[model samples]
Target: MSVCKVIVMGVSGCGKSLIGTRLAERLEVPFFDADDFHSQANVAKMASGVPLTDADRSGWLDDLAELVRVEQKGLVLACSALKRAYRDRLRAGNPSLQFVYLRGDMDTIWSRHSSREDHYFNGRTMLESQFRALQEPEPDEGAITVDVSELPDRIVERCLSALGAPDRTGES
Candidate 1:
């Protein structure tokens, strides 16, 4: 089987983690939430309602990039990846890497964010900063854009279809 490396990306509250986890299960690969890679300092900054600077994110991105570099069987990564440069860092040595952008309207996402609990990204201001920093993938970037309005299962199906991945949901 060919390895499939995918980055499920978007601003917070866009359901990247939810869909990416299900997508990885369907694809029979490991799923990693980028939130796990953040430093305590970064988390604290975010918890304090401060947007992370590039310096704050560089090390975390490097660590994730390295994880991508060494995963022999491929894995699904859920990351905000709001900046083109951040995506470029992840794309560095992984030519087969593909990105799934979870695009959604601010109002829709804000509503979802408001209803969610126990997440570090709770501030509306940070969400706005994320939008300000987002650079939607260009036509040549080979990203698959999926609307976040869809259900998680449907979103995963759309992503699998777009990537030509088989639905391996029942294998064991």
Candidate 2:
């Protein structure tokens, strides 16, 4: 079977990890959360409520791009790819990379953020910065945009359908 390389992208509170994990399981592929690949300094910066500048993220973006290149078996990655440039960087060498943008307004995401207990992205300022930085994929980009207001399973199904991949979500 052919594998699907998917990137579930959005701002911090938009459920990229949750949806990406579910989508990977349904697609029968490995899953990767880009948060795990962040540098210690980047983690510390976020933990301290400091937003990362492009310089801080350049290396991280390169690392994620490398992951897409090296993980030839195909995998789903959850990342806050908030800039068009970052997405372009990820697609630099891997043209088959598919992006699933989890789109939601600040109010919608803020509610989800407030309920999460373990995430280090606790400051509203960070959220604002992310929103300010986000560049939703354009019409010609061939990226799928899903409403974050939907249930996680539904979002996964939507992505599968859009990608022309069978939904093996086992939902009966």
List where candidate 2 sits over 4 angstroms from the true fold: 167-169
* lDDT by residue for model 1 (1-172), tens: 4899999999999999999988888888899999999999999889889999999999999999999889889899999999889999999998899999999989999999989989887589999899999999999999999999998878888899899987566442
* Worst 10 contiguous positions by lDDT, candidate 1: 163-172
- What is the Å distance of residue 37 in model 2 from its true position? 0.8
Task: Give candidate 1's whole-model lDDT.
Answer: 0.92
Provide TM-scores for the models: 0.96, 0.95
- Prediction 2 TM-score vs. true: 0.95
Per-residue CA lDDT of model 2 for 97-127, tens digit only, reads 9999999999999988888888777588899
What is the lDDT of every predicted structure here? 0.92, 0.90
- Range of the 10 consecutive residues with the lowest summed lDDT in candidate 2: 163-172
Instruction: Report residue 20 deviation for candidate 1 (angstroms).
Output: 0.5
